[model samples]
Target: MQEMKAEIATKNSKKANLLDHNSLKHILDESVSEIVTSRGYAEDVRMSNVRLFIGTIIIVIALFAQFYKKKFPGNRDFLIGCIVLYIVFNVILQLISYTKEKNAIMFTYPPPGSVTSTGLVVSSKLPRFSDLYTLSIVSADPKSISAGKPVEFTKSVTQWFTKDGVLVEGLFWKDVGALIDDYAAVPKKKK
Candidate 1:
């Protein structure tokens, strides 16, 4: 883990330039394609599951009602109730997913000099690994790179916090690049 972190911090050869804008762009693109997109896809699958579960429940209830010759106000009311439940549950899920997406893409930048810090749990390492790389992109000159915008990716446990509850500092190269590409407020110069 430390080795990987070091590689992210300093590339032994000139092959990987972590500091360059193009590298950042690459990281951001990979993040969107791998992390963010997967998260969105998972949410979609979850929504589909909700739909399937509701449909199954509704059918089971309708079948039972018919088999038992049960009547509630009218046969229509039973189906109507099931349909209402389906809509309500699906609506709630949609609202939750939407809220998450909104929160995830918060491209916030404080005053240039102001410190924007988040803690990360490092193994036996003092305090945390500073997410300097990610935060730096956000803090750099407006002309250099676009910072604080809603992250295109979902805020997962790995992305948001560590096992011990510390907020993970820094982002994977993929996340940094993807974020800049998708959410950078100022246009980045091609180097």
Candidate 2:
């Protein structure tokens, strides 16, 4: 884990040349893709499991109702109740999935100065819905990197996507890049 963190930090540091607006925008764009793809994929897998579990429970209840129909004359009422409950459960699941997709946050390492103990968090609102997303960066103490301790947040940066995960493609990048450049320019005290 430490090795991977070190490698990531090295790579980010190398890519800290925020003077080039194009490069910075490209990096942010790439990060958005990474965040969405990874988080979306995980959400897909989890929702699939939840759906399967719900289906299994519904089937088991149905089977029980069918097998005990003669012993329990109330089987018809019980089965109808189960069916209604199944429908309600399915609707609830759909709502849950939609909520998750809209609000899920994927944390990843940001370029240089954007680093934080919790790193960067990316989330989407889905283009068809509102075509917006929130990208939050929390600045951390450089010394925490070496100490393997949680860093303190000295600053924060928040950017939003105008269309899905894509930025407005103008001064936004410059503003964001300037902040990161300023942060990265800060000298760290040696432990």
Candidate 3:
């Protein structure tokens, strides 16, 4: 009986040791995974910040070039070159901005209703024209409107047009409303 008790105690001790070791290993693994995940997120945020900072600097430089062109109108070639370079830089910056924003939206928001040949169309409880315009700008493709026929603008090439809040009125609000209505009417498939 004494020998049997000793054997049982020894077995229990070994079992306890193994359980403790497994528990410790599990804790360590969880901690390491958390640290790795946090580091990855931090790196992503840092990269985004760097991109935004660089874009801002480029835009500022572009604005300075515009100012210089205005200050020296006689140098037409230099002015034109600066303007072209500025536009190119601006387009690059906008592209980067759009990509980042799209990624964020995709990650945070629910999946869009359906992705057509053009782009994603989201269904909303309340649809507004301003919202549609903003969406069009974000989507960056005028061809995304897959619904009703848009009112054909039949103005001459020389016709001057401006936004409502601007110095001159351009396209009518009714036209914009129609465009939005058409966009909202686009068919969407279930996810």
Q: Which candidate is the best by lDDT?
A: 2
Candidate 2's C-alpha runs over 4 A off are: 1-52, 55-74, 103-121, 125-191
Write candidate 2's Cα lDDT for 1-191 as tens digits: 99999787555531423333444445554654443344322222444567678778767766766676455565667777877877877787677667643443443443444333423333323223222333433322334662122211221112433222333334444544543344335466799
TM-score of 1: 0.26
Better of 2 and 3 by TM-score: 2
Task: Give TM-scores for every candidate, taking all chains together and pairing residue i with residue i.
Answer: 0.26, 0.31, 0.29
Give the residue spans of candidate 3 off by over 4 A: 1-43, 66-71, 103-191
- lDDT of all predictions, in order shown? 0.39, 0.45, 0.38
lDDT of 2: 0.45
**Local error of candidate 2 at 25, Å?**
19
What lDDT is reached at residue 41 by model 3?
Answer: 18
RMSD of each: 15.9, 13.7, 24.4
Across 100-152, the per-residue lDDT of candidate 3 in tens digits comes to 44422111111146343333222111122111112121232335553223222
Native-referenced Cα lDDT, model 1: 0.39
- In terms of TM-score, the best-performing candidate is 2
lDDT of model 1 at residue 121? 10
Off by over 4 Å in 1: 1-74, 103-191
Error of 2 at 50 (Å): 4.1
Backbone clashes, candidate 1: 14
